[model samples]
Every structure is written in structure tokens, then in C-alpha cells.
Target: MRSLKILLLSSAFNGLTQRAWLDLRQAGHDPSVVLFTDEITVCRQVEASGADLVICPFLKDRVPEQLWNHPQRPVVIIHPGIVGDRGASALDWAITRQVNRWGVTALQAVEEMDAGPIWSTCEFYMPADVRKSELYNGPVSDAAIVCIRDVVEKFATGFVPVPLDYTQPGVIGRLQPNMTQADRTFSWFDCAAFIKRSIDAADGQPGVLASLLGGQYYLYDAHLDSRQGTPGETLAVQDDAVLVAAGDHSLWIGSLKRKAQAGQETFKLPARHVLAEQLAGVPVLDSSIAQQRFNALAYQPIRYRETDHVGELTFEFYNGAMSTEQCQRLVAALRWAKARDTQVLLIKGGRGSFSNGVHLNVIQAAKVPGLEAWANIQAIDDVCQELLTARQLVISGLTGSAGAGGVMLALAADIVLAREGIVLNPHYKTMGLYGSEYWTYSLPRAAGSEVAHKLTEECLPISAVQAMEYAMVQDIGPRCPHTFDLWLSQQAQSALTNPQYRDARARKAMLDIQQIERCREHELAQMQLDMVQNRQQFAEKCRNFVFKRKTCQTPQRLIAPWALTYEAGMPESRMLNG
Candidate 1:
């Protein structure tokens, strides 16, 4: 490879270009910078760094006529958007379209914006919780850095431009032409797939808009309900959830923005409140009145339906608050079922919830003196190990919300079944408790570390479809009017009679594997102790903070652990007071 001089053109400060220039210089190459902006920032910075500088107009529209004429050995443009999605407001355009994946392309400068052949591309998947600004500020910035590195590597090896493989199928050609004002207007009747795609594309950018109470609101995450209701009628609010009616389906507005007198602010209100307010005086339109409709929908009883299938057992979890005793009872029942040659276990919650998991408030309040906490954790770990090692195919039938411990329990199952509207949340971090019960291993194994980290660390909700995509859920089914009973019947038949069912034999093998690899008694006990101590300290800190009191002085023995765990590398003032 022959080294050559490199020049970069960018309108705004390009972190990639700057970093690449530094890397090139470190590697003994001559690199220069130019700005398309009218300001002298790039020129001054380039001159100060002993590099050449050039001024040009914007690179997107005038690149062919104006900017590409530069004589630099290899003139490169760092496109902030994905290669196929290059254009002005590329990031904005992508967000408006709800694209799940995006990339940055380092291409040779051509007359048209982003028309040059690609040198290299780096891509990243967008998370649902990531805001529009974050996509540009984080992933987009990271993309620029990647492009810069590619450009620098190309310059080191003698600049050879490679054209984009347009002949390849699925290569998006041509930029998105600017949209008219009319084209930007929001439409509620769009097909579910299109709406979902558009929402994902626009994620963390801008462009998705909806009219709510005469104010324009940017739509973030939304769900389509096939159940029809009056268009624009408010349905119900459950805490921060807002339900609204659309043409063909009801739209559950998980989050919303309203214009405040001061400025635009987002509100996290329940869908029920919005629904009641909007439809207060209107005649109840649906065949089922909202009260009866909602109640009829909320609590549906489930019965255990036995099947002869080797890997299928169908049972329903009753609708009610979760208790530790109930969890223990369920575990015992599963053990009994396992002893009876049950190979496939399907546990579904009644109505709108699978299980809320362990009650956080209860766990927090339980003064599990250090030793007891460890003992409890060990017991929980045993249950988790049993679930993992069960000979039968263990599946969670999730019909409603599964939160925190509930999600972990579902994860313990080999497979999970969910209705489309089920919501899964890991609410541990928010409550300041160190997550335990083997979820640390089970969650990452089920979903990739990146996703698991986001769920555990940020306390984000995972929808059933998203969960399915992440391998968190295996099957998605619709609720039968007779409830999941009929569904269970079919599932049981499939499990008991299916010639291919391997769950019984599989369970024995899994148990043997667990005995060898996931010994539940030893490590789990210690982990539980650690979790309990951490939670106790965390609760103390939170209580102190709430009461405007300082944290209690740490005992000298405890100080060592505190420094090792939470206070390492902190200054004296920031360290725990002893």
C-alpha cells in the first residue's frame, strides 16, 4: 500500500475526521481538513494542527459542481447517515421512517451528496428506549468515527474508490427527495406494518406526528389494536399508559407530548385517564361497555389442562398480586408435575398479566438480616436451576404484563409464549436492589448482553413482539374469547400426541447437565448474601436521602467492603464516612 495525502469535507465539526486526522498523524501521514460551514472554526483548527485547510459550500447538494473539484490526493466525505440513506436531514428522515438499523459510510466525494461509492460501512441497531436526539448524538457520532477510520485506512493504502454494489438486490438507490408539507401530515389509518416501520425509522429523530387534543404530538412507541372503537376516543389510563382509538384498531400511546403554556413537555399518564376524559359524555359505542368490557378483559381464570405430549404442559396463572408463598407453591407444583413424567410445561397468567414477579415493595421491606437474605436467595436460585434443568420443555404463557422477577421466571423457562400486547419489564435497578435469583445469567443468555444490559440497567419495558425478535419469547398467539382454555387445549393436544416431542428425555438430560454445570446450592447462597447486603445499604441511602439525613457512618469493617464495592477510587470527601 502506498500512502497519500487525505482531505476531509464536513459541514459541522466531525469527530470522526478529527480523530482520524490524529490517528493518521500518529501513524506519520499528512492529513488536512476543510469546512463547508461559513465559519472559520475548521480552518483555524486545521492551521493550528499544521494541516492544510480549504473552504467550500455544503457537500450534499453542491458536491459535484463545487466541492469535489478540490485537488487533495483523496477527498473524502464522512456521511453521518447510512450509505443507502444519504441526504440532508438523513438522520431526521431515518427517524421519521422508524428504521431499526442504520450505518455510516465513508465514500469518495462525488458531485452528488452521498452518491460516491462506499469505502466501508459500520452499522448499529437502535433500541426502542433511545430518544431521537440520542441516536444522532450517540450512534450517529459513533458512525462518523467509524467512517473516519475507514477513510484514514484507505488513505494509508493509496486511495482507491469502490463503487456501491447497486446491482446487488436490496441496495436502496437514489436519495429520498424532500417531502412536501402535505406529505408530512400524520395519518391514523396507515397499515400496522407501515406504521411500525415508520415509527422505528423515526425513532430518536423527528417526523412522526399525531394530533392530540388540538395539539400536535410526536408519536414514539404505539400499538395497533384490531378491536375497533370510535376514532380518537380516549379509552383508559393505567398509570402512565394512554389508550386512544384509531380507525380499525385502538392505539395505546405509551408516551405522549402536549404543548404546555411554557413549552412542549412530555407526560407519562395512563391511557385510562385520557380515555375517560375524552369519552365522558359520548354514548358507549362498542358492544361491550368500557366498564364491563375492561373487567371482562382484566381477570380471566385459568385451569391446568393436562396433555400427553412429551414436551407440553399447559396451565394458567390466576390474576392477582404475587406473593412469595404463591411462588413457592407454584415451584412445588412444578416439581410434583415433573415427578409425574410431565415433559412440556406451559404456564400462562390469567387475563392481562403473567406475573408481576416478586413484589418489589415486599422485598425492600423484608428486613432479611444478612444471613437470612442469603438463605432466601439460595432457595430462589434452587428454583431457577430446577426450572432450567427440568426434563420437560418449560414454557411461559405470557398473556399480560410480566415485570421484574416475573420476567426472570419467564426467562428460566426454555420457551415463552406471549400474546401480542404483553409487556415485560425488569424493574430491579429502579428500586435500587442488586438483581439476583440467577437472572444475571439467564437474562443475558436469553437476550444478547446489549439488550439485557439496557433492560436491567435502564429499567425499560420490552413489548411481546420486541421480546420475540430478541428470542425472549418463542410464540405469539391471540386470546380466544373462551379465554386461553381453548388455546391450552390445542397446545396440550400438540404436546401429548406429537410424535416428535422430546421434552421428557430432554428434561432428564438437562437435569444432568445442570447438576454438572449449574450447581444451585453453593454459589447462589453467597450471591444472595451479597445481594441482600447491597440492597440493605441501598435502602438506607435512599431513606436517608428522602428524609434529608446524611448516611450513617460506616463501621470500620464495613468500610473496607464499601471501598472495595462502591467507593473504590473515590476522593476522601466522596468516600463513605467512617
Candidate 2:
């Protein structure tokens, strides 16, 4: 690839530009970034970047003509909009119009604002049902990366730019300026289309301002219903869903925020509830509402400490929904447990979900930094393996849904105890990633190769009873009668006091055999990599098979014996607390 000089004009406040610059550098281009802000803060940032810093008068219209015509290399301006759409608030306009498809484009900078010739564009489709906040944070941000990657790839290949045809139908659109207060006020007489569009356009960044009986509220997520009722009249209330009347139709206001004396308080209401009856007469709340809002936003992190036991340690794998900070905490806890002499380690999740797997947010956030996210995953894997290899028993108490990485965490346990309603699912294939956390070996051992293969390939949710019947779980204990804490206490006591357990352990020499089996399993995992591309592909194949069988009536297929025996030498039952 031929190296070329590149100048990146961006906002100091924009994270997208920083990410684009990193991508360009990784692609072997000599890229320099300049913040397009009049503030001194932006100047300092540009200077710190060790790039040529030039101060321009206006962000939209004042690109230095000389720099744009630079002879040494091309000057490309990254516009956070799709081809044919230009100017500020382009995204906001698209959202207001409920446009299903939008994108970001990198174009050659020119004298006119947003009038540059497009170099490359990356397009993405927004879900029709998505809220405005979701559209901005999810698809819009992702589209930026997509566009940047395309631009960099084109640059690397010595590709020539094609000029866009302005005369082509549906190929030109002007920009809209930032929204004003008047633009956001909600009108009760507006049509369903207008109301829905208004709600979508107002999203979180520029929220909708609605006058209630006496105070103001911001509508976040809402739907339009044609059912007629008196405007602003309450209909009914269902958990977390609210229905209110518009002029000609009823509007389902799923979530909302009220402007408080201090700030805003997002209150989730029940569906079909009468908004006028419940909140119309009430005066705007002051300090009490503010306290409630604060309390609502505060969330406590789950923390588990290892107790003094040879075989017992606590194992907790983050569900894919976890944030980077949460994953960091989990890794730290695992390291602490590994260093200790816990005999039987119990793996559990606090909520209804054992784990969803690795946090996709972290992955998306790390795209700008390239492989840094994978490095974090590797760290998590190391911590997980430490638990798997511990001399003590590794027990998994799966009380609810365990999907993707969550399933791998349960598989890592020597014994898995699942509640009656617990579900085991592998969901990686649909999202275009592999299953990590050593599930490739751990799964086959727990349920046999046929079941493991089917679980991954079919991507079906296996019930707790089915799991136990298939040997995925050691036992399906008492149904709905006992809570997880109660079950754990009973199991721990049984392991600590049962003389039969001790006697059998001494006679069978299980520990030595378990150590040998774990080694063989690790070796098998190494060998599987030669057959499969990565842990993700192996996981994806397994998930595809499972999803394919979701509607089948036959008993779920299992993995072959060779695959099961490949890791069967590993111990299934060991007393962790003893």
C-alpha cells in the first residue's frame, strides 16, 4: 500500500474523529488531526496530538482553501451524514422524517459547507421500532466506523474517487440547522404521523418539551395508536407502558421524563394508565422528586468475596450486557479467588440472567482502538481458566437464563445446578462473533459432544430439566421450592459433612485423575483451533445448528462420542468447600 499524507478536520468534542484518526494510522496512512473548534481547549488538544494545528474562523464554511488544495496529499473531511445529505442536523432531520436508512460519508473538502465530493459512504438501516436515543447511539455511531474503514481501505488501494452526480434524482438534500425550543414543544392536536415524528426527532439529545397540566415533561419513547379518546386523557396502565390520547388518535407513551426544579426525572409508567388523572392536578415536585430520581439512577455493583475453603471459590462471568468497568471488577474478583485456597467455587449471577456473555458495548467502544477490546477479553479468559483449573470444586448455580459466554461460565464449573426454569442458550452466531471462555471444551464435557454441537448449532434454549436429563447439569434439584441461596447453603453443608463423600474420594483417587483430564482437555482445545478458524466460528456454527432446531419436535441431537471423550477425563463432581 502506498502511504499518503492525510489531514483530519474534526471537532474536539467529537469521539468519532479520534476513532477515525486511529483507524487511518493503523491502515498505514500518515494521518494528522486538527480540532475545528474556536476554543483554546481544542487548540491545546490539536497541539498535543503532534499534528499541524490550524485555527479556522467557522466550522461549516471556513476551511482554509489553500489547505484544501494542498498539492502534497489529499484533504478529506469526514461528514457524519450519508451521500446527498449535507449541512448541520442532517441526522436529526433524518430521524424526524423517520428515514429507515442513513449513513456517514467521507468527502473531499471544498469551500462550501457539506458540498464536498464524496470519497466513500457507509450506509446502515435503522429499525423502525427503535427510539431516537437508540438510533443515535447505536446505528449512527456504528455507521461512522463503517464509513471510516471504507475510506481508509480505498486510500490504501490507490483508488480513484468518482464524482457524485448532483442532477441524479434523490441525490441532493440541504442541511437543517439545530433545533430550537419552539420546534420541540408537543402539540396535543398533532396527527399520529406528526406526533410520532416529533417524538423520534426529539430523542435524548434534543428532548421534546410538552406542557402537562401545570408543568412540563419530555417524551422519550412513544407509539401512535388510532384509537380515539379525549386529548390528554388517561386510558389504562400496564407495567412500564403508558397510553395517552392525542388529537385524533391515542398515543402510547412508553417512557417519559419530567422537568424537575433541579433537572429532569425519567419516570416509567404503566401501560394504558390515565396520565391526566394521575399527574394533571399535581403541582411540579421539588426536592422529593429529585431524591427519587437520584435513587432511581443509582445502581450497586455485585461484589463477591472468597471464603476460607480449599475447594470453594466464587465464579462470576459477566453477561454480554456488562460495561467495561463491570468486567474489570469481575476480573479482579476472579484473580483474588484464584490466589486464595477456596475448595468449591460457586458461580452465580445476581439477577434473572446468569450472564448474557461479553459486553458488546465494550467491543463497539474499542473499535477505535482496534485490538484493545480483544486484549481485555483475553484477560477475562485467563481469569476464567484459573477458576477452571483450581484444585477445589467449581460449582455453577444457574438460576436463570445463561446465554453465550454465560453458558461457558456454567460449563467451566465441575457441577452445574440449574433451577427448574433456567435456560441454557448460545447466541453468538447471529451477531457475527465466536464463542470464547473455553466453552468449546467445557460444553462438550458437560453435556456430551452431540448435545454441545446441537446447542451451538441450533442456538436453542434448553430447559433445566432437559439439561439435567442430558447430563448438562449434575442434578435438577427441588423445583421452585428453594431459592438459590438456600440451595447453595444445603449443597455446601452436604459436601462439608458427608463422610461418604470423603471416603469415596480417598478410595477413587479422583483429584489426580481430574488434574490429568484437565490437561488433556486444554490440549484438545489447542488442537481444535487447527480445525476451526477461531473460538467465534466454532461458537457460531454451534449456534446456527441450535437455532435451526428450535421448532423441531425430536429430542435435541448430541455431539459425537469422540468429541465428548476428548474432554471427559475432567472431573464432574468435586467438593468445593471441603
Candidate 3:
């Protein structure tokens, strides 16, 4: 198909939107983004874009009638629902309702949200016990991409879309109301499945509110446990997660957000940290002892296992935001893995997100946010240092999207392998951070000075394919998590016998440790000014992130190309479509 001008309108440049943008651009389409600000601004930007197609991949706001009624341009909404389905809480309701199948629909925008003529649709099996965000990021996103590609193909062929028809087979979806706190609420007295499903349905958004220790709190990031205790009572604490007993079994609550009281602000934090005072008397589950006593299902963010000549160290931090304690724990794990007899070390990140740097919610909730921020950055730097000087050949498996220091942390490995379709944001300007995961050492070393500079200064997200083009990553793996795991294992095993890889490892060991140390110190010094001194208002930005404050307008960098035209008061004479 000939290259077409496309305008992507989204509430935020979220994972799905970023993926869609990257896919379209890589497919040779001219695409630009316009974040939702307000009805007037959105309409104005749509008019000014003059795009041949408008794709709202991840929008929350309604499409303005002005643009939908326009004769020349066609507006498509990538709804995370099947045909005949409509609503904002589609995923949440699906998870809560335990639907066996779910899908994504690409349809024309109309006055009614998610109720329009369907351009294309793709369905997939709904995996059991998946969180709402995970469901969206995994199968739903994949299906949406499939539908999007089909939409583009059909549009190019001038094919007409079919209107929603109830009589059509496989059109079983219906409108679901916006989920409420009451819909998500569940008691500890409820069965483990019920509680887990409820919490999973509300994961990452408006969390499930429940009464705990005489205080109201919102819960998130749950895992099942077999241990038994009094229902509704705290059993134990381990790795900042609290074990709470359910009717049938126990659940490990990884994070909690205290419901804000009058004149108070609250954000999500590790459950143990949020209820430190209340959990002071709770028995702590030692990971080392538990590893020997129980199965591998014990609640722990970081885990290590050796198979043959490969040692895999996996960490699944909540939302991939590592706190000071979490970072310190990972540092210990890296040290342990380095001391193992394994020939290769595979550092696999979580499925949700690899890592997004320090935990902003934890930093914002600290008594001294600056000091906490400083400690968090230093702790992560320690992990990178361990990887930089490791004896074993280090390989990072990025199974999910990562941003800021997280991108650099992965670069610390000898070979960085990123999953296809994962987005990597390698800059820290948005968070008002200089960043200190030894990025100054890792980024330029991996991708050369020019590419590194462009990545950091531009503050834009790059696709995994783009990262490989820039030499930021050594290879790209399959998008499927299971397939990627198998591929990563094969690669790790193969590297053990590859003379070229061994030679690379030898050269990496010969690097001047002094220069790397100096780079780290410089990065830390800059971070100190930003974090401790608040030179760039890191505190404000951190709060804005944790508090979910929306940006007043889309960043100029995102819509930079059209900014000049708008400034000059130029008419929209097919500026982009032409």
C-alpha cells in the first residue's frame, strides 16, 4: 500500500499507543500523535493534522462530532472489546466475569462510544488469572495490532466496513457499564479465587478498596499462597509484601494505597511499607529459609535458579518500579548469581514492565523524598555495577516495555535481548532526572555516542527494532512471552559454546573499571543536584506522577512538526497527507 498520513490520538502515549505508532511508522506510514487535552483542543489538532486517517488506539475521551462528521477523513477507534461490545470497563468486566474469550475491534468513531461500524476484529483466548493491564498489554494489544493492519489494508482497497449486527454469529459482546469500587470490592472472608479475580480486575487503575487493620485501603498486585491463617488477618510479611488470609487460602498483597483521609494525599507503596506500623509485630518470611523449605511459588520479587551452565535470575517488581529496598535486594541477587558456577547469567525482567527506574510512589511517600530518591538511585547503580564487572557472561532479557534508567540497566549486560514490540524510553528528562543506572557508561558503549545522545536528548521512545538498528540491543526475540523465554534459554545455552561470545566477554572484562566508576560518580553527582537539591523540581514531577496528574497539554516534542505550521497561521492544505 502507498504511504498514508495517519494521526494517532490517545489519552496518553501508553504502551499500546506506542506500539501502534511504531508499527505504523515501521510499515512506512507517516504517523503523528496528538494526546487528548480537551474537546476543543482535540478538534483543533485533528483539523490542523490533515491526516488521511485518524486512529485512536488508546483513547479515553470521546471523539468530537466535528471530526467524525468530516467527509474527507475517516476516524477509527481501536476498542479493546469484541464485535457488538462497548464500554470503558471492557477488560475489567471480562476478567471479573471470567470470560473464556476476548478480542479487540477496530471500528469507525460515532456519537456513541465503541458502538460503530466495525472495520476489523480479532479474538484470542482469555488466559486464566491475568490482570486487567496484563490482558490489555498481551493478547488484546496483539489482536488490536492485527485488526489495525487489516484496517489499513481494507482502507487502501476502499473496502467498506460492516455495521454492528446482533443477528451475526460470534457477536456475543454487549455493553458493560463502567466498573465501580463496589464492583471490585471483596472480603478476605471470600474465596481466594474471588478475591484474586476481583483485585486482578481492578489492577493498575482504581484498586479494590478494603478495610484492613481498622483503616480503609486500596489493594493491588496479588499472588496466591497455600498457608492458612485466620481469615482477614495478616499472616506474615516478606519482601515488602503482606500475607493476608482468605477463606479458602491466603493471598500475598504486594502493594497497598491507603485511602486518603481528610486533607491527606496517599499513593500506592509496598504493602509492608504502607502498613509498617501495623505490621511491626507480623512474622517475617525469610526468603533464604523459604527457598529451602517451600516450593518456588513462595512470595518473592527476585528469584534465581541454575540449569546446566546457565543461571537465570528473574525479578518481577510491581509495575517495574524498584524501590530502594527492592534495588538492594536485586543487588544481592546479582552478587549471588555472579558467584555461581554457571557460565552464563540471564537477567530476565517481569512480564508487566522490565523496569521504569526508581519507584516514584515510594519516593513521594518518604519522610524525606530527596534522600529516599538518592538512596534508590544509588541502589540501582550498585546493581548495574555488579553486572558491569560480573565474571559470568551477562545477558538481559527484556520481556516488557521499559523506560528511563530501566533501559540503561538492561544495557549493562554484555548482550541485551529485547522482545519484539516492546518500547524502550532511554531518556530521563520527563521525570526531571539525570538518571544514574550507569547509563553514561552503558548507553554510549552499546550504541555509540551519537545514537546515545539522540536517545537521551530527544526523550522519545524507540521500538525494539529501532534499538537494534541503533545497536542498543544485540538481538530481538519473539513477542510472545513463552516463546521469548524458550528463545532466550536457547540463546544463553548457545552462547556458552560460541567462541565469538566468549571473546566478547573477555574484552568486556578488560574494560577499564576506573573509567566506569568515574562515569558512575559523575552521574550520581548530577543526580544529587536533581534529587537532593531539587534543582529541576524532581519532587514536583515525582508527585505529579504518583498522584496521576494529567499534563496540561501534550509536550511540544510530540507534535513538533505541526507546531511550526500552527505558529505561522498556515492553512491546513494537506500538510501531512500530501
Task: Output the number of the TM-score-best candidate.
Answer: 3
Which segments of candidate 1 are over 4 A away from where they belong?
A: 1-85, 88-104, 108-117, 121-159, 162-183, 187-201, 213-216, 225-229, 235-254, 259-342, 345-392, 395-433, 437-578
TM-score of every model versus the real structure: 0.39, 0.42, 0.96
Off by over 4 Å in 3: 262-264, 289-296, 499-503, 560-578
Q: Rank the candidates by lDDT, best first.
A: 3, 2, 1
lDDT of 2 by residue, 1-578 (tens): 66544445553312344344445555666555444544333333322333222212114435555456544345566565678677767766777667777777777766777677777777777566455544544455556666666666676676666665678785645555776657666678777567777777765445577764455767655666656777776554422345567888876564455555666333322221225366544333222111222231112123344445632333222223443444555666555555665655666664335666654433333434224335544544554576566565666777556677777767666667776545566545544454566666666655678877777776545556667777767665543323555676467546545563453224223434365446446644542452233444533333333223231121112222222332244343311110
Best by lDDT: 3
TM-score (C-alpha) between model 2 and the true structure: 0.42
Q: Lowest summed lDDT over 10 consecutive residues: which window, candidate 1?
A: 554-563
Tens digit of per-residue lDDT, candidate 1, span 513-558: 5443453444454445445556436555434432334222311321
- The candidate, 2 or 3, that scores higher on TM-score is 3
